[model samples]
Target chain A: MSQFVMPSLGADMEDGTLVEQLVAPGDPVQRGDVIAAVETQKGAIEIEAFEDGFLDRWLVPLGAKVPVGTPLAMIRTGDPPATPDIPQPKDPAVPPPPPETPQPAEPDLPPAVPEDPPLAPEPPAPPPEKMGTSHRQRVTPAARRRAAQTGFDLSALGGDRVISLDDVPSAPTADAPKPLSAMRQAIAAAMARSKREIPHYYLSDTIDLTAAEAFIASRNADLPPDARLLIAVLFIRATARAAQSFPEFNGYFEEEHFSPSAAAHVGMAINLRGGGLVAPALLDANEGNLETLMMRLRDLVMRVRKGRFKARELAEPTITVTSLGDRGVAGITGVIFPPQVAIVGIGTPGWQPMVIDGQLVARRVANITLAADHRVSDGHRGARFLRSIIDHLQQPEAL
Target chain B: MNDKDIRALMIRQLGQIAPDVPFDTVDPDADLRDEFDIDSMDFLTLITALGKELGLSMPETDYDQMRSFVGLQRYLSSHVT
Candidate 1:
């Protein structure tokens, strides 16, 4: 049997009313099928089944309020719970999603739960090793089979602990991506501060990327895999070089004063492998040539993803660049990260009809947007800075 | 290597990028991005890994040709000795 819980959609949500049940008992439901709708603080959110099963029974009736994780219904999966018998597609060019449970481990501090300690004597309990050899002997052959069937590594139970049938974990669900609660809070705080403090002005331009695309293709043709540049490298390079001439958009704002840095330390936003976003600085972003810049970007991306980013690299960004070209978004208007006066957003590049020298032809184009602190620089300055970035992208050989 | 060996190696390398995906059920002709929702970085990372494994280079210009499982295997078969 499996559970369909009352899922908490927001951080502050405590409980929700089951306004309606979309599926009745005995209904065969597929994964991702919306089975119920709950009324929370954020209005009605339709909850979906996480596993393929039939609804066996409803634990909570309609109009009942329940807290998050309170199972609303029981589901009959009708088979031995799926173990990690993952079939790797023999000829797959497309890989299967990683067979990993996305849920974070419980916030358990330690295994030091005190079990009826006598305060007067304070004598430590008998060590597991001293009383312990019996614990190993008590392991049933059937329990070992249960552990193996569930793909729970038996060695994980450890030599110190007693093994029991109850200790075997059920099949892990890799269906959902982990919710990054801690990272989400940190992002919320920063963005909230940005909105509260910075008076922002936004500017956008549709720039043709034919020249840049051709340049990257030509350059990457002969380079090794490690040395090759992704299109993001160009976005970073262009933003950094453009910030060189426009000092207003390229510096820190602190203590009611705007101090423009001589060098542009562009913060390139990278989405991590599992989930979450990090924008670490590429030190001396404007000074390096494209080859050197690509090398730095590669190193920074690799290091940040591995959670090995240096303190200085994480903190030294003067301006930020977020490129969403690959995800297929047209444009994004970013809120300026506090203390940084400007952020550049690069949207997806698409083939658009453009007239070049009186001939209408298809060319690669992207929407570049500038969101700057209006307290330091107005729309005129922001527009000019965006224009300069577009100009730099025009001549990739020069940039 | 035989086709079986090549497929096994490809799945293993892809496993590194998408640690939670079920690779065995993916259609060989499906796009990795569409199948597993891998972004550009993951795609590039996969290419880098494939290059390292096969001792070859796949230029950005040729990424589209290697978009599917069958396509990647073909690319490796032709490029690898």
Candidate 2:
């Protein structure tokens, strides 16, 4: 017997609601097949099976929000499907009563802390003037600040329970979409945890993309518009190769130990149409050529926009790359995602005057930044990694 | 087809790719990207849909010629059978 559990998609995710189940009991499933769709604060993600087996049963029901590592289903590996203990009634008129077996002692275990004393005082409730009727309403600190900042009536939330950050609107502008405060809090908490635990070092470089632009333009000249390549694919391909060479930056640092990943699964930060951003991995990125990476990147972007993602794409990113798409920002300094030691960021590529062999010439340049865990790699090695990416970008056809 | 019929078809096809685009307020002469903030993917989808709808083949180099509403119409008119 094997257990299929709810995978923690990212450092910030705690629980995910199972939106759907794509597999049924007794169905044979292969590894990498999408078996379920789990919805997190980020979006709806299609969860994949990690092993080949016959699904025995679903332990979690649809739309149930389960914590990370909570068993979602059971699979039978080597044995035949077990016959259910309780036999179904032959007559449709009479339904059989549920079995009266005693429950396990795990639920009866003592709580982590006694209920006698609280850890800290609850935050001061919102004032009556700020909130219409629910004066002493429970609200998160971030939500409280946002309410105060926007002057939004807390009573308008229409909930008697705790008002979370999701209740607060970033702005009252009619056209602006409601901010995804849950994703924001998740990001904040993870960033805080990363800052507290990982010693992060930052490196930035401006690379000339003249050769890459020409290469892409020629490459796409014959192809249709939908098949054209973007600079992002090049960046991801180069980063994957650089990570292959620099193994130190390509894995998890857990329990005060660094374990490098065998394959380079590069995560690309894709911004959703509605709001928040998600970094889903391109599996075995180092193995693919530019054409493969471009096709995969296109598919990944479309899936992300439509709220469809495989579990492996979410859970197995060894390193992350975030590009501010067409925003024209010169550079960006990124915060490290926890457990993973490194994150690479690429800013917009724009035309700039450059000195080529002492003669001034115009060139398109993009700034690349890397944030690495200091505990796993030093500034010297980090610089080399950045340099490797730069060299790869210059020879665009080779990528 | 006349210009009016071609314009209507173009709008319908563009809407298929970008449903949120405010066709009522869109300027035919202005750049679609500048006016609507359409990214590369959306632009590609719109171009592909137009090509398929009109039975025209548009190479990558001619993408700039199809940037605006009127530009796409002109390109399709010239290239279409």
Candidate 3:
């Protein structure tokens, strides 16, 4: 028999929650078959089978929290072990069984004394003003310390009703700690490593969106309710096309070598309302048509907002894009997600005067910044990639 | 049932779930969630995998009690008997 253990999804993760079990005991599983779902710091991932065999035993139950490498279940390849008779151990050197006790004889005159015992009745105890007065209330240690530090009376705050300190705001202590949610911790580790390890080089370009906006307006007039394209969809499509032009930017860097990939898996940095971020991918952005890209982008954003994005959605991005359109930020530079060579940051569209064939005219322009790994991509290549995206935006009909 | 066998099985199982994870350096005491970012679904899959490998009956409710390596070891030890 072989045990299947919990897998560490990333470099920084230590533990994971077992969110769901896809397979049960006695099920035949093969290699790469998804057996269960795990919630990592990154996101929920499907745990795949390692060996082909019958699922013999489950070491841990579903929804159990487990450390890295903890045996989650087992598979039996050989013949099943025969059932062994586990002996119930007897107490060693046991004393002889206790002698049977003899019963006492009742007196024959007991009938004469039974009539005098019912003369007095006992008094009942009085009920207290409040119930559960002696019950201990649950409160954290921090709350206890806060109540001690401040003159605030916890008893008075909750009244004489078996007061609980939960409602009382705990004073922050030096050791006041809360477990980091699986997502937040993962984000912290990834961001910290990206800042520390990856050498980021940023390049910014202002693209005239005059044609793109007009093209969008024209398309929207005839588009279906769900097929209407947003500026983000246009940015993604144009970036995907630009990635094709600059193949070097659409790949990963590993072992000091740049591996250019054919697929343009575009990841979008989505800002969650409470201030965390998740970058779910629009896989194969170049393969889909305009309507498909629009629907996919919309779906990805909705999933991201609801925190229901799957692990595959966040992994294997060849390139990433982040936009601050709703924030009204004109332009901002960003760091690249490591392994992936480049990330494009999109800014809010603004009206700016531009020289159109030597004559000054008001035009809507969007600022796009590309941050690339300097070890893999040089300044010239990065600039050209940014320029190509701008060119695509300028001629929107071509995208 | 031996310790070495169990460790080897663990390494093999971990590799299957995370193909890129370096098994040789994995610390047993590390919280898989905090240290490696293993999520709930992955943990469940791991349990299912282990159940198939070890021939032990583990129910869903048992997962709630088995949060750490020691917890898992105790759970297996009890049930394997």
Candidate 4:
């Protein structure tokens, strides 16, 4: 028998809602068959089978949400169906026999006359014996008193039904109500863990965006509506390049080991207006040109904003970049979105005075704050990474 | 503000914080933080925008009570009145 469980579609997808079941029990299924549709943080995705067999049972029903690796269905290869035998009821007309025939009033016992003993016993119909009911089972003294005072029927309320003194429910108190959505709960857990476990170190620098801004404007003038450049795209591309320069930043932390990756998958923290955040990855971002990066970023932002992103998009990001320029934030330190070693926070663009060779000149500036896990990368390496990103942003034509 | 007015304000505030969020698909009673991924910064931005628009001082703790649209509407209605 083969088990069809919800596969780990991505590293970050821990659980999913069984949105729909495409096949039913007793159905013969083949390899690559779409058995069910599951919804993750990203969106609805179909789950497929890996081998051919007869689907024996549907362990999880439609609308039943389950964790990743939970068995959703089972399949058996060329197995015969087993039939269960049914039991017939006995005739109700026949009456059951008398349990034991009154156990034949024990033989060899003699009957005695009651006249001799009755006289002495009668002398003391001992003043009506006081009913001293010592509780045999364990119960609270308070409960006993309450039962005595209120005449609460002890027989009806006692035994296993009565909670122990230590197990009694306490008085009700108000608790902060929490949201029930699994996705939101998971996000809270991840963020809380990230904030708590990751030892963060921040490095901030002002990038001269004069040339980049002009380049973006000129490019936007000739581009279509969907292909226009946003400051975030440039930030994403630069961050990706920076990650390549400092591979230590693009990696996941495991038990006593820092596994640095070769690929530069950038997770962009896209803000949703109502009240949450989603960081979707722009995969192979370092290898993409400005146009491709811009297009992919545009598509991702749009899809994320509309809540149409797939589960795959939220996983395996080597690094992350969150821009607050649109919301008018000049600069803010972002917490390292964990497992990933670094996050780049982009501030609103403005003009700042800087020295060029021997003369002071005003230039367009944007503060970029890089928050890295200190355990994985140090301050010197972080500075170098930031400088590389600044270099890329300054030289837009080369990016 | 009335309930309708509060909803409109929330939708507008949402747009400002997350220009890409789909307002029409959201449940008014759904937690803004949970459903839309609004972070603390976004929450602050929304409160600031709403404070400026309503000309009222709203406290940070007030956000805790304003989870859903109905909840926010009720809060605004009670406090504004």
Candidate 5:
């Protein structure tokens, strides 16, 4: 028996609206079968089933948006015609199904926080303009000065005697921090969960990208503007190459077991407009050349922005590669999105002074960081994985 | 086409390429990339849209000349007619 859960498209994607159901509850699902269309900020994506089974029952209804890892349906294994796309892990070892018990509406999630928490009735404090004058005697001289500078709402202050400078926050709390969108709330929850549950260990490597830069210029020189490749494609390809070698870093961690993926399914993290981000998989990242990868990247990003992508592209990412992409940030430390054990963060590349061949010279370089789950791979192996990426990047022509 | 209408055409493409960035604050002389946080994919999409709209062939070698609004306008002005 297997539980069909909502795949984590990105660490940030918390929930998706179930817009359409492709398969009925009783349908026999082949591996990689499209079961439903989920509406994310990236728009509607058809989600696929990773396991082959007799679709037992629908735990979630159409139009219901649920958190990632929530069991949408239960799949009964064995006695089904095998339409093999992915090999089964436990076929001969299939034991009798556990005694039937009802699954929850959602699992591994705390009670949903109301979009807007109940507000206290009209702030028991004095009126706005009245505070500066009437409460002027109650506030300390320094506090008054500080509050004025920060535009802090003096009316919100309470208690008998006086407010101190320490009481005045540097920022104006009077102006409420913009309420996070539903997607933002989901991102916050997912990140908090990743930090709490995953024993994340990080390592960063500064690699000279001089060779990659030259390779890019030479390649783009004769091509059309529409066909030119960017440095990011190299980063994604290198990450895929590294994950191909370091299989431990390229699979989901669930139920206290670590299963290595045969091929690297690289998640290309795309930042959505306004806010939030989604990292959908680019299947078989290691198989393509730089030009091929660039074309694939272009098509994926274009579709994602338009809000149309296939479900397998959203679900099957075993490892994710996130790039700052010329934003010019020095480096980034990523959080391990469960159950994927590893994430590769590519920072902005810039020319910097470095010693090479016993001489100080300027070299194009970037700092790449790896955030991996320690439960699956140690920092030592993680270092080796990052090293492979760095080396692959140094030889951009080969990749 | 007049420069103003051409600017609008380019902006229309940018609006599709990066739907979030505000063109009101954009510096015409500054690189579109720096002004709009436009990356390679956005850059490609922009060229593709403008090329399709104006029926111009922009080779990769000429991309540097089209990095800014003033430069792009000059390039398009010379090439379009």
Candidate 6:
């Protein structure tokens, strides 16, 4: 039996609580099938099974917080030599709607206490509190989980030793519309780390999209509505193609070394309905056509909102693109997510007067900006990379 | 489809794109993008959904014309058979 340990969702995640188990003992599972939902600081992440086999059993009980790399379940591969069979859970009949009695902290204290405090015992060990009192700031696991979900710093509650349910504040007293959710906290931490470590240089240029728009219009005229392409798809395709041309911006920078990736996985930044944002990769972006890319983007957006994402999507984005086109922003400069060398930002397209063939004509134009790690590339290289995107966009038939 | 039926269908199609939009508060002539939080994606979804429901094909050239409630109704009435 092969052990399925908790897969780290992102660099920011330390530990996560197994919220729900989707598979039962003896159930067959494929490699990519989602087997469990883990609640981390990032939110409810659906954990996919990495190995194909019969799910032997859950190793960790639900609601128990465990650090990263902890074994979550056992997948019976039955491939190698005689393996020891793990006994099935005692009550295997009941599945995971209600977590089978959270393993209570097995205390060292003596059991079998009288209904009333035994006579002659000096104030009889004060009715052993259900919540642990040994720790100076004792907060119940359930309470801590709730606080994390609500983004309230429990440490804010001054030196109170034993914390009860009532001690946790429900909301933050600030002007913000809503208190930062766990996802927002995670995003902030990641961005802060990105900005602190990566020395970034930004370049912006307004690209005329008149020819590209016309090309898209003609191309989309014959297709069905669902199959029709969006300008954003063109944006991604062009960027992917440009990255293929200018290889400097399309890879990870690690250990004071720049590794250029052969395959371009463009991370598309999707804003969540509830506050934060996640930029999951559009795998093999350079190879796909506009139609396939659009469909994949649609599916990715849908799955992301539903909290269903594969592990690779989160971890494998070599470069990211953040489009503020929907919101009427003019231009944006992104802070490169650490390890990833560059980030591309696209602004809203608007009609602007341009001189075409010595005549002023209204053309659809958008500001495309590139933020690259200065350690890997200079402004000249960044400008050339941006020019490549413009060149591809200008010739949309190639995209 | 009749004008009233088409309008009703259009509202339903729009609801699929953005369910939280208060239909009663929606101004037919105002740009939905500005009034509500309907982005380009939602706008495209709305157009696609309408096309699917009505068995019509909406070209990318006509997106701006069909962006608002009034614009969509006018465009559908004129372009659709």
Per-candidate TM equals 0.62, 0.77, 0.57, 0.58, 0.71, 0.76
In candidate 5, stretches whose alpha carbon ends up further than 4 angstroms from where it belongs are A1-16, A21-36, A48-179, B55-57
Query: What TM-score should be assigned to candidate 2?
Result: 0.77
Question: Which regions in candidate 4 have their CA more than 4 angstroms from the true location?
Answer: A1-13, A21-37, A40-59, A71-184, B1-81
Chain A TM-scores of all predicted models:
0.55, 0.75, 0.67, 0.66, 0.66, 0.73
TM-score of 3: 0.57
* Winner on TM-score (4 vs 6): 6
- Cα miss at A166, model 1 (Å)? 36
Against the reference, the lDDT scores of all candidates come to 0.73, 0.78, 0.67, 0.69, 0.78, 0.76
lDDT of 4 by residue, A53-110 (tens): 7777777756665678888877777653352122323436333432433221112222
Q: lDDT by residue for model 5 over A211-272, one digit each (tens)? A: 99999989877676677888888888898888888998999887889999988889888887
DockQ, computed on Cα atoms, for candidate 4: 0.07
N/CA/C clash count, model 2: 0
The sequence of per-residue lDDT tens digits that candidate 6 reaches over residues A75-141 is 9874432443545547654344444543222222222234432223122232355486544556777
> How are the candidates ranked when ordered by TM-score, highest leading?
2, 6, 5, 1, 4, 3
Predicted candidate 3 versus true structure: per-residue lDDT over A1-399, tens digit per residue:
899888755334566667777776666788878887776555566677778876766666556666778887777665433432324244354333334322111121122223223322221222243575755444455555455543334555544343345655543222323335445656666767778877888889898888898887777655333445667778888899999989989987878799997989898887664457777778889886787887787667656655565544565678989887633479878777766888999888889999989999999988889998888889899999999888888787777
What is the number of backbone collisions in each predicted candidate, taken in the order shown? 16, 0, 53, 8, 0, 0
Candidate 2 wrongly placed segments (more than 4 Å) = A79-180, B1-6, B9-18, B25-28
lDDT of 3 at B10: 60
Error of 4 at A44 (Å): 5.2
**lDDT of candidate 5 at residue A129, scale 0 to 100:** 55
**Where is model 1 chain A poorest over a 10-residue stretch in terms of lDDT?**
A104-113
User: Residue A66 of model 4: what lDDT?
Assistant: 67
Residue A226 lDDT in candidate 4: 43
